[model samples]
Structures are given as C-alpha cells and as structure tokens.
Target: MWADPNVRAVLVLLAFAAAYVLYALIWPFTHCGACGGGKRTAPQSQGRYWRKCGRCGGTGKKIRLLARMFGRNP
Candidate 1:
C-alpha cells in the first residue's frame, strides 16, 4: 500500500487536511494580512491617512477561512 504512488499522494493530502483542520480549531485567528495586524491602514494613497484595516475591520485579527466554513465566528 505505501509503495503505491497514488496511495502515498492520498495519504499526504489527508495528513495535510487533518493538520489544517487542527490548526483551524486551535488558532482560528490569523493576523490581518492587509495591515499586518497593526489595525490601521492607509485607505487612499501612500500613508495619506491611517484608518481601520479593511480586511479585519480594525480588530487586527481575521478568522481563518476554514474556521468560518466550520461555523466558527467570534
């Protein structure tokens, strides 16, 4: 079974999926990519005015996509 290429691929993918789910459950929040968790971003040009991050909406944290899909919202 382990010698088969298809089997190895499937096992690797399954492990990855399991790790992703575990991560989603453990740490459901990730840094705001848009503002780098600073909670502020310039909405207009280069540093014109610091405002709330559009992605995380100023909370500085964004719920993981997997968490949202699993009905986790906080």
Candidate 2:
C-alpha cells in the first residue's frame, strides 16, 4: 500500500504543505534574499552612489506569502 506512486505523491505534497504552514507560523517575515538584507545597492562603476534596494524597498525585510494570507500586512 505504501509503495503506490500516487499515494506517495500525495503524502509528499501534504508534508510540504504542513512544513510551509509551520514555517509561516514560526517566521512570518524573511530577509531580503535579493539584497542579502542590505538596505542599499552596491556601488556601481558607472557612478559612486548607493540606491535603495529594489526587492525590499530599502527596509531589508519582506513579509512571507502565507503571512499575508494570515492578515499580517507590511
């Protein structure tokens, strides 16, 4: 019974869902992976000015998708 491919797929999917839910509860916010949690962009060769991060809007934080579903807004 446990060897069934269809059953195994469903179980794997359920496990992933459960893990994501737990992750959402434990960590509703995550760092800006795009910017490595930095508020500004690296200095470019074209100029020597720093700009705000595009991914995190210079805040260095991002709300998780499930957290938004749970009513935790940015």
Candidate 3:
C-alpha cells in the first residue's frame, strides 16, 4: 500500500488536512477584544503608537469563533 504513489499522495494530503482541521478546531479565528479588532483609532501622543492588545497580546486572536458559535469558551 505504501509503495503506491497515489496512496502516498493521498495519505500525505489527508495528514495535512487533518492537521489543519485540528488546528482550526483548537484555535479558530477570532477578533481581538482589545483595539476592537484593529478598528479602534489610536491616539497620537507625540508620535507614540498604541501598545499591544491586552486581550490577545497583539496576536488578534482572543476567543475561538467556533467555540463561541457553540456557546463554549475557547
């Protein structure tokens, strides 16, 4: 089975798909609570910039969207 090129390709594809699905399930995309998902306007203080998001720490990912849809916290 492993010797077949098609089988190998399919296995690899499946592996990748599974990994992506797992990752998405665990960490679905979410808007950052801080900065209001980057929509908040920053105040210029002597050319100073805004700090990192306090909720997602500037990662822009707060809670998982999937979890929120399911009424669960991620």
Candidate 4:
C-alpha cells in the first residue's frame, strides 16, 4: 500500500499541507514589518481593542494624547 502511486501522492500532499500549516501558525502576519525599519506606529483605541490606524501609518496621534493630558481639546 505504501508503494502505491496514489498513496505516495497522498503522502506528498499531506506533507505539503502540514508544512503550510506550520508556516501559517508560526507567522500569521502577512504584512509584518519585521524587516528593515521595523518602525511601527501606535494603534488607535476602539473601546477596549486598539486597531492599527492606516491614516497615521499605524502611529496614533501623539499630539492628541498630549493635548488630552493638558486638558486641551484635540
């Protein structure tokens, strides 16, 4: 049974599938900036969760934080 062509094909497909699964689990992010620069911006707070802001390139407005801390309107 192991020598059968169909079984070999199935095994090869399963091996590839397993490898892909492992790769995906280890690196879930597709556009992760782990490469050069690696300078990521702050995320915006949404109730409790903070999502990456596209407008500011993921960097939340720092000035806004300072203004709020100083009791000024942002």
TM-score (all chains, Cα) for each model: 0.76, 0.66, 0.46, 0.42
Per-residue lDDT for 7-65 in model 2, tens only? 99999999999999889878889888877776344556353327677788777789999
- Those runs of model 1 whose alpha carbons end farther than 4 Å from true positions after fitting are 39-49
lDDT of 3 by residue, 1-74 (tens): 88999999999999997786677677667677666665544655553346776677766667665456655564
Residue 13's lDDT in candidate 3? 99
Report the number of backbone clashes for model 4.
1
The full ranking of all candidates by TM-score, starting with the best, is: 1, 2, 3, 4
On TM-score, the candidate that comes out on top is 1
Error of 3 at 49 (Å): 9.7
Best by lDDT: 1
Residue 65 shift from truth in candidate 4, angstroms: 34
In order, how many clashes per candidate?
0, 0, 0, 1
Q: List runs of model 4 lying over 4 Å from the truth.
A: 32-74
Error of 2 at 52 (Å): 3.8
Residue-wise C-alpha lDDT for candidate 1, range 1-74, written one tens digit per residue: 78999999999999999999999988999998888876464556565436777777777788999999998889
Per-residue error for 46 in candidate 2, Å, reads: 17
Model 4 lDDT tens row, 35-57: 21233434553333234545444
